[model samples]
Target: MTSADRLWPFLCPSHPDHDDQSLNPVAADAPSLVNLECSRVLVCVAENDLLKERGWLYYQELGRRGWIGVVEIQETQGEDHGFHLYALGNEKAQDMIKRLAAFFNREMPPLL
Candidate 1:
């Protein structure tokens, strides 16, 4: 199981409204992927993050389901989850920010 799958229960521990499928989109039925409402999607993942697998899974599912939207996954080399938040001065973090800006503005440069 992916780290996100393993941690779903604890995300809202002691709460009555815990939905196991809430944490991982891959947990839902395959056909349900069509229900995701978006014309574009960007999944940013850290190369060394424990949850990176989940990001990949979600990205793959979008393609496997033949969803009618552009989906992209960008992996930041040598970074951990949330590194952009913790190390804003890092070059990789700055690159990620620029990439995100490009994604938001629909100006995604061809992935290098």
Candidate 2:
């Protein structure tokens, strides 16, 4: 199955047989993230991930659309999709977890 198919259950409205909306962000409009209140965005992508380029494109698009907050990406070299989840003890994973914690603890400045 494709990545979108795998993500559908998590990111989209449920299929005809399922009615779970708990995991959905409830945002019908996602491409236009102008309404997002967060001041900083962090996107992490493995070097060989299926969505690597797409993640970068998303960051660039956010900038193109005048995102006022800082946008950062942590590209894990020589890794595949979901590497951190499966390789929890790996150095890259540890670093990523630390970075994520730091990002979460950071204070967000007012949007530009």
Candidate 3:
């Protein structure tokens, strides 16, 4: 973890004051993570993002959990956080959008 993550000054100033178990859903005491009303989960992590490790941790923990749902992670190599937004028409961004549409409901219908 970096200094900003540890201190949480920029993102969430009061984060350090909060309990770690509650702050991090992947914490050991966070059984509530398995109880969210979602039926499926798709964690998208960009390879060079600062939060990539956290994304992987969430994906891994949720998979091992006995929750009655599906969980998986997709890593975009050589990309940083919010790359999809910046490169809206890029191949990986379009692929991620398709995956997200499927995750929310059905596969996106053909554009034609």
lDDT of 3 by residue, 1-112 (tens): 5532765444566556323554466665566665766676788989887667777877887766655567778899989888888998999999888888777885434322
Who is ahead in TM-score, 1 or 2? Answer: 1
> What lDDT does the true structure give each of the candidates?
0.77, 0.71, 0.71
Which predicted model would earn the best lDDT? 1
RMSD of each: 5.1, 5.0, 6.0
What's model 1's lDDT at 96? Answer: 93
Residues 1-112 of candidate 1 have per-residue lDDT tens digits of 6565456556767532333355457664333777777678999999998778878988998888767778989998888999999988999999999999988987434422
Candidates in order, TM-scores: namely 0.77, 0.70, 0.75
Residue-level lDDT of model 2, residues 8-89, one tens digit each, is: 5665554521223232222233445555577888988998886676678767766777667788989999999888889889
In order of listing, the candidates' clash counts read: 0, 0, 0
Candidate 1 is scored at a TM of: 0.77
Model 3 residue 85 CA deviation in Å: 1.1
Clashing pairs in 2: none
